[model samples]
Target chain A: MKQDSCQVTVIDRKRIELARKQMPGAEVLENVSEVLKLLGDTTRLRILLALATTELCVCDLAALLEMTSSAISHQLRLLRARGIVKYRKEGKIVYYSLDDPQVQSLIKVSMDQIG
Target chain B: MKQDSCQVTVIDRKRIELARKQMPGAEVLENVSEVLKLLGDTTRLRILLALATTELCVCDLAALLEMTSSAISHQLRLLRARGIVKYRKEGKIVYYSLDDPQVQSLIKVSMDQIG
Candidate 1:
């Protein structure tokens, strides 16, 4: 029996050429990374998770995370800027929630994959 | 009618206090990030997608992507390190495939979310 070890690595020129033409470009990857990186953190992930399950005001998130409302506000600011979450102002009381359905789906999938 | 802007923001001490006890910690978020980051890249995501559909050797991937086998190997190395993908040997020919079902699920969710 002969193993491929001694043989030269095979090059599927046609396939490789076709893929180079078909694969996505830098812009798409960069965009995807931005979204994932936002979800990559402990605080943000928790914030997003909490929001996904239910809309909450800053005080609510602060209470849940045991963090300062100031701290929670800072993270929420980032999430809002990226369009990952959205807020509705009802007077001084602003409630936040996941802005995109994809965000919720992505998080659910993330949980399933890790589990 | 007075908007809450001029008023002191209300803090739901009871709700906030309760939530702090329920949320997750740093460890879980960090672990989830690891998986998401691997899929964050364009090339790696592409590789994972290819493998998810069909197992292929390095050369097959290289051919399909129109990349040098060396470039493909480098990406595969990163994916393997993260446990995102795996490979088997047939002589010198090593074939690769995704190691977990979660990877596929995550990608699908990502696509749906982004789409």
Candidate 2:
């Protein structure tokens, strides 16, 4: 395919360099990638959106999104492993919520932009 | 597998609800998911970071990242299709850069948090 030539004004070039310089550490890239990967999936995104509204157990999440509990469990496991979500035990039930405030804020900002 | 119980404090509940409400449009979710999915890959993420610093054509991007031109081309195609990156043609070379300021800002903020 024919590619178009792009021009980089001095200002944008400086901005890009600043962005790269400001990027977090190697470990942070991994974590951010993990978080982004988790958010990449539609099912997972919806699950997160639902959870963003309320702390729900696997079953409740499944019910709200009309997905299977097994699927929700699998996605939740991914999110939990990435530290994007945390869970607590109440008897035999497991309720889950955002692991960090940053996660909520990131989602909020993205939502605000898109909304 | 046994799941852990999670507790939802009122504050968190309110925050989550607010996040859900604030999330952009269904279209933005699709777009965000597209962008995130593109960034989810290590190769693509590295490419974006590199491009985030400078406007580079396929050749420069491939050379800087030490990847094949073919690979860079493919990834750039995805970025361009999603409006994450735009390119202009100058002779036989095509230069690519970020399509929107939001992308740069988002990357910067994420890097800041993790850094």
Candidate 3:
């Protein structure tokens, strides 16, 4: 396949170096990648969007999205593990919400653009 | 495997109804998922971060990320198709940058939260 690159090989070392310096470190990038990957799924994204309005337990999410509670909870576990979502206990019931405001804004910004 | 859901089966119909009404449409959620999935890759995310500073050609992205121009171009094509990134022609050289301000903010928000 023909590579999608510039025919000329002029390397702007200074600009590239500046961007590299400004970029977050490897560990941070990895964490961000993991977060985005989790959010990429339709089910998970829907769950986050629903949770954005208010916290919901697995049953609530499943009912809202029309999926099984097992599937919703499975995704919630992954979200919690990644720190994208947090759970609180009220008696025997558990509610899950977005852990980071930044993530909430990420969804909001994305929705505004496409919606 | 055991499910990770609340044992209780009390569905808050009112809350779920409210959340469902407040959520974005299915099309928007799918679009957001596609965008997040694209950003989920480290190389693609790094390319976006670099472009966030300024536009660059595939060769420039390759040099910055230590990847081949072909690989960079491939990801760039995918990003362009999804409207996440845009490219312009300067003589014989082509430069790519984030296509939407919303996408730019998404990256910024993600960076601020995790960085």
Candidate 4:
């Protein structure tokens, strides 16, 4: 028999069972993975990090990043759809901000990890 | 003239300038995005989550996930390369665990956001 990298000489049944039970269901894992994928983009991550500090209008984000307003809007639309960001209209100018504490926490924790 | 979705009727130069200053450099942003991308995968994320709770050898993880040892080892190699996970050899068995507190924080915040 070919030696497998994961050779099971001593199986810790107790630990394995505990980890299996702790694992989230498939649906939740899929949902969380999708959110992480959305955030995996540099443009979107920058947008969220910028928004975490302060709210800005679409054009403001474009200006801040030196990117086109249209480009910024496209990413913002995706972020909004996922509830990672929220926007409100103030007399025709729409201001976008982090949707909730959860979004802020995500940004903070991820940044801490990379920094 | 076509109106852009991010039409700038009133420019907030101060906020825009502040946000620009606050934005991380390209290298840092790239690094963070890469980390997020790695965790974005369901298998890798699950593996990390499991290791977060208890240390497990490669075969242990394979059994817990009901996946082949080769698949689990593949993901572990990637995670190990990124410093997201660490492993130690005990005789012929290698045990894997989370590398740092940063990884734990990343998992917790992300789960909180999704939950």
Candidate 5:
């Protein structure tokens, strides 16, 4: 029984080591978690989904979302900090769009799969 | 000036409507947010990442993660509720594995893009 248990322990250890190796980033997992967390909010996810299709300014997003510009701005800040969205200013308007194509692809694929 | 302002308002309303139409699930968005929120934690994300590679029992995951089995069990419960992971009981052990192929694919794509 002791010998059998030792062998099982060794196998478990090996399996874990293999999992760690395949995962690659113990460091970036937090960043990934944060990004996923940001997407976890329905409003934020909808905002990202909208932005993925085209660039839009705060006022437009607010009008479309039926939300205040302040709410839209706050969500955009979170998305921007994670490098998920990018924006450019023109006069008094700031236009926001997805910074990474992967993000857009992710949103598209997830939405399709879910539907 | 009134005519010009009306044109701008119409354009803004049109843009908002377009955003709403493109994103189909105002209903399921909440569920998606919940799933994403569940995946938002580093430990849970790691647990999912580890499970993505192979089927692992709670004890093995705890050992590998250097966390308590209780903690691993809690995380697994969330993942299971989200339908992200599935398990089967055999004798005294319950083996857990990724339930959805799309989930595995998403993880692979995201990891690759990040790296």
Candidate 6:
């Protein structure tokens, strides 16, 4: 009742303050959430997992995922937009890899945890 | 033309084989995606971030996030089902924290990557 009635209900100020102080800024939190959300997709995640191990051209990714190069390229475009994956152009081939080293850690850590 | 007409178009067999070899099993990838999906929500992620720093009860989380205990409990249930966070009952209070160490790493690694 008190909690409902009160404009401000402080259950544990220490925790409130602690969580507040340690909380990453709003932008960072938003970016982190966005990154996680983007990583949440199955096909995209599969591509990332593959790239985490080594660089892959669209055709290679398509072969590995049993999909088409066009399909793989579409998802890779989304990943590239989010800055999660980057590509290198060598002649007519474009190879993609995880843009951030910490991304590999994120995947490895999450996979290890799941295992 | 060659790629489209053929059911199997091998761009670079070596890269595909390497990716397939390094790819995690299907279940692990699914679970990892599920975990990341669970973590993709803002409220759930905020709760996890708080717990990553220290343990907190539903009341504490609600108060800190400025939400009702019932709302906090609902999200906590989802998080619990996914095993991203765990809780212990003490008296009338239930304290929650991240279930897996690598979850902390996942968050930390992502945050670092974003930075």
Model 6 C-alpha lDDT per residue in residues A9-96, reported as the tens digit of each score: 5556687689878888778788788778878888999999898778888877777788877888888888899878999999988889
Write candidate 4's Cα lDDT for B2-115 as tens digits.
Answer: 223444333787886678788888988888888888888999989988997899998888877777878999999988898889999999889999996776788787987885
User: On a 0 to 100 scale, what is the lDDT of residue A21 in model 1?
Assistant: 60
True contacts kept of each: 0.37, 0.24, 0.57, 0.57, 0.43, 0.56
Better of 3 and 5 by lDDT: 3
- Could you give candidate 2's per-residue lDDT for residues B1-115 as a string of tens digits? 2221333112233434455564445776787776667767767777778777777777666554456678878888887887788999989778788876777676666555643
Determine the iRMS, in angstroms, of model 3: 4.7
Restricting to chain A, the TM-score for each candidate equals 0.79, 0.73, 0.76, 0.79, 0.77, 0.77
Per-residue accuracy of model 2 over A1-115 as CA lDDT, tens digit each: 2222433112233444555564445676787777767777777787777777777776666555556678789988888887888999888778888877787677666555533
State candidate 6's DockQ.
0.52
By lDDT rank, best first, the candidates go 4, 3, 6, 5, 1, 2
Per-residue error for A21 in candidate 6, Å, reads 1.6
Candidate 2 docking band: incorrect
Q: What DockQ does each prediction reach against the true complex?
A: 0.30, 0.20, 0.44, 0.46, 0.40, 0.52
lDDT of predicted model 3 = 0.82
> DockQ: which is higher, 2 or 6?
6
Query: Which DockQ-derived CAPRI band holds candidate 6?
Result: medium
Where is model 4 more than 4 Å wrong at Cα? A1-10, A90-92, B1-10
TM-score for the first chain in candidate 4 comes to 0.79
Candidate 5 TM-score over all chains jointly: 0.84
Comparing 1 with 4 on TM-score, the higher-scoring candidate is 4
Q: Which stretches in model 2 have alpha-carbon errors above 4 Å?
A: A1-26, B1-26
Candidate 1: stretches off by over 4 Å: A1-10, A17-30, A59-63, A66-71, A90-93, B1-10, B17-27, B57-75, B90-93
The whole-model C-alpha lDDT of candidate 6 against the native structure comes to: 0.80
Report i-RMS for every model. Answer: 6.7, 8.4, 4.7, 4.5, 5.1, 3.3
In Å, residue B105's CA in model 3 sits off its true spot by: 2.3
